[model samples]
Target: MRRNHTRTPLIEAIERHRSIHPISFHVPGHKNGLLVGDHPFYQGDLTELSGLDDLHDSHEAIREAEKLLGDVYGSLESHFLVNGSTVGNIAAILASCETGNIVFVQRNCHKSVLNGIRLAKAVPVFIETEWDDAGTALGIRLDAVKEAMKAFPQVKACVLTYPTYYGYTYNLKEIIDECHKHEVICIIDEAHGAHFTLGSPFPESAMEYGADMVVHSAHKMLPAMTMGSYLHIGSKRVDAHKVKEYLTMLQSSSPSYPIMASLDYARSYVGTFIKEDLDQTLEGIRELINGIERIHPQLIVQQADDPLKLIMRLEGRTGYALQELLESVGVYPELADPNQVLLILPLVKKGLSFPYTEAIGRINKALENEPMVEVIPMEGISTSRRTTPFSTLALSLEEMDGKVEALISLDDAEGEVSAGMVTPYPPGIPLLVPGERITADVIRRLNEYIVNKANIQGHHRLADHCVYVYR
Candidate 1:
């Protein structure tokens, strides 16, 4: 029997309850939008009362909604995450690896991956990621994975980021197959790829490639609320019960009803996405691109593997400057790095309209305005792309926990282990992880990033030309 993709069990249940206009005796002080001045959103801000099910121990509406989610993704089990992909990543790692286990990690994974390893007390073998001339960090190559597995035959699990923040994807199927050959659990942080399952123009999902587990930030590409995400058990290789246990422990007991409902709606939105919708979305994106290029012939628009993503850049101008210019004219981009600004185009169904002309007009205005910041000298820096195929932390997270740390200049910090993770915002790939050694190459890259006016995140006083290092 075919499952009805149109059915939103959780939302229907919430609606059924809302239709009753029940009394306000629940834990939420808002009392079903009564005290909140009928803000529309508060109407669905419910708790685990009556028909609304408990997230941690889902047996009613949430269970049915998750079942529908699993059907859509073709996973053994699927879950709604209100805490974002961060918790999903952590829970998946916790469920897969044991203390002191060797885990292979793509070097450019989000800091959350490293945090998961730390919390699990697992050791990570960082596989160096490849980069393009444009400085976009492409995902780990298959050869790198083979090399790491050859070096560490006892690897217990592998965690990878698919379709990087810039929306670049490589041969993920081959990589996942290799991990399976070695009986290593494969987990993918497909935060930017929740729309992949819609097929055709979109890249295939990691779940389709037989990953043991996969996490998605539905809000990234879908119409879900912020912090809404999904975790899928793609294969039986991972302990589904354990994954659920970790999710229960890691997620909030009091989950947001609105976020959960949005997750349900997001899944259904894609689940029912037909050929007409896909064609419509692709056409809109195509028109948007054409308009952007037609108006600003100087802007270099680079489309990634995912059609929904585009990178816009101008020679001699840092992405930071471009980002500011766009924001000043009321046209905001997803994020800006040193080299380019990333735009996540809308994934609209048929009959829906996005203001593409207005957006292009705004872009024209923004680009025509005076430069937001003085163009920093666009000096070429060493790409710092190559490292040993496999590297390890100089000290484990536990070892670094109680150690004394000091702030020092990046130039002088060479040979010291980093006390914190220093990352560029938006892309959020760590320049220096908590226990990684500070090399001269790392210092050079840091200096270039600072000079380019990139927004550096995590622990660092880059404005003062210093970073925290373990004493």
Candidate 2:
């Protein structure tokens, strides 16, 4: 099939809609951006009109586009999402599990998954992951999920974040099979993995496997307008009708036509040119990694199952420090933590080579001239701790317990129950959740927060400040 690189059907559709000069009887007051002057998107802003189909009730144009998307992804059904992947995650959770059902979730999933649990009112059984020697956390191991299912036999579903924000991927096929054996539905948060299905050399997407439901943030990697995403239902195991109901409830009544159009355009873009672009990008990434390896032998650039996510580590400086240096050199990574910085490479913009080469050169020069120092993994005092959910934690604060105390200094927090979830944002996984008793180990870890000067949220009191607590 000969593909037209410049002609985009979605873009053409929007243009065609504008040509009709439809009257303003719809919800959007912009009236095709007539009220908002001189905006690039003015012409594309549209409401449902003749020929242009409605998002929620798709019978014409929207349905055709969605069917095309399904064909491209090889899924049972693909629903266009204008709201971010958060909506898709919530819909998937709501559709798969009943209210008050128990769900096993990876400890390090995004805040959206947590929100989904709350929205569904499902009880979450957290499955802990194995920590590396350096105390860096990875994906949930298959054995851990199996053990969790064994312990919580009634768990209705299991949620996993593939290729975590840190770029760690687990064996999805094995995990999905394990979940299926226990009659637990498998739902995946592939927000960071939107580009995985472009036939890139990266690991296969969750949808590519047998995941019952998969949520993707197309804007993360694809050339979709921001907030453009999709909710994919793989097979009959997932209740597609229930999913549709939840999606309608969660989504905006008046959807953005421009965003929807962009999603359609992005799907076509990947189908047409992604393979070539991905190959070129992978080669560039290889060259970039090799250059860094030659210059700084002591530095470690972590490789992932994903080719798009680039993680680099420096010896003398923390990942946060290195991130700042990279930003100073006009090279910004997607996200950074104490140990690593993640870069999201878009296949759409693969040909730009000088920026990457120059950034590598700067990093090499900095490593060579800078004084070498031993890279020490941050450590802290250990304290006795226990884990509890946000609901239980909140309830516990109201109930008097002599063992629990109000906020105290990190140095003095030993022998105290943690009143909140101490976690780093961007990747908002709770390190020490509320209702957990603080021990010497917890206090020691709390004190070592110099890296990134990371701010901890999800708590009322921190560092000698006490908000309300039980007894």
Candidate 3:
């Protein structure tokens, strides 16, 4: 079948170059697979050849391709990234703010942004999300941003995660306008919504609404090799020159040619066929939803604010338990929390249709005659008020002085502070951040999680079988 998308010029150029064998006089020792005899796609992997341009100092092919990407996204500049969205977050944070500057960030942001703040030595003003008790997930509200800005007017930048891991998206246009009114540069982590520009049935891409900068993990939702991502400078508010400097500093000297090629290929794929691919994927999803409704009748598939992500809740099983069952049946989920399992359906992939359907059928059959189990809400522990510099608290776990243990009683940890970010992994918002006081409410949830055998991390156990508290 003839593909609808235009072939990526750079990728096509490389393919055309590969068709006719060229002499080996370039940087990569592989020399068109001669050096690395068994390497895959080595013949196409050439380093800075006469015609092929350099990624960092692009002038010809790379420059042209990136320009096309910029044009496609309607950005001031777009740089193809081989280091994933983590690097883009770091680069964006570093470029936009200086040390001691305050950055208002969504509390549910990826650890990468937190690390970027730490690296930049910037003060973080966390904007807490409105937690949906029934959903057990966070939904971003514009009012929270307004409240945070009111409290921290000196915030230099506002970083938000658009379409959170569970596919919850805030109103971007309104938020962007609000940030601009305050002269705060808006940096959006569009890591999960890279294919949003291909158009609905997906939420709008951050770039569409005039964010100062947007970072996308192309590999996450598009058919690009893993770790492929892009950093888009949207408005004149962003200093593109500084962003380039930061990108150069964070990026590796020797870039992956194959990964870059895949990125270029993916851009072309989205440019040409993303609409059709998305339509087909949505149809498949509709079919899956209908099948589940017909078969299980009682299973609740949590509807996402964004359409691409599929989240479901099983009547009798925890998300972890369901995840195990899915794996046993040769199906894998993108993320699973206590109450839900998430599936990321990439428009570019075709392998998930049958297996996903079959897996749902199996789950339905297993629950056929079983009575629906009521999901019990466990009370979480709260912490006492204590203010400490993050620098003083983030001392190495080994230096903190105790063996890791779980199931600590709430009564014993009265005056102690926590040494870890204790939260559910899939959602990953810390319930008790490092150095926070541990209260009975916090202990209650930890104990319940332990009793229920939920996966836990980052704490030590004492000889008394209680969780060892950090001093």
Q: Kindly report which residue pairs in candidate 3 clash with one another.
A: 380-441, 381-441, 381-442, 382-441, 382-442, 404-460, 404-461, 405-460, 405-461, 408-467
- Please give, for residues 1-471, the per-residue lDDT of candidate 3 as tens digits: 323346575676677677777787876877788877747778777676666788889997788778777766778899999899989999999998887788888766877787787678777776755545434445466887787777777889988898888888878789889999999999999998877887666788899898999998889887888989989999888899999998988998778878888888878767766445666777777776776665555567866877768887776677677677667656678877666689786574333343546766776665555465775653311122112111123333334445343354555875577665565454445555544467665565556556556555444442233654565
What stretches of model 2 exceed 4 Å from their correct place? 1-10, 21-27, 134-136, 295-298, 348-355, 361-369, 377-423, 432-451, 455-471
Expressed as tens digits, the lDDT of each residue in 1-471 for candidate 1 is 548989998899999999998897976788888897988989998999878999988999999999999998999999999999999999999999999999999988998899899999999999988887778877787998898888889999999999899899999999999999989999999999999998878899998999999999999999999999999999889999999999988888899999999999999999999999988898889888898885554588989999999999976677877888899989889998777899999888999989988998898887764443444544333255555787999988788888999999887999999997998776777889998999887887788778877778888888899999988
* Window of ten residues with lowest summed lDDT in model 3: 380-389
lDDT of each: 0.89, 0.72, 0.72
- lDDT for model 1 comes to 0.89
Per-model TM-score, in order, reads 0.95, 0.85, 0.82
lDDT value for model 3: 0.72
Specify the highest-lDDT model's number.
Answer: 1
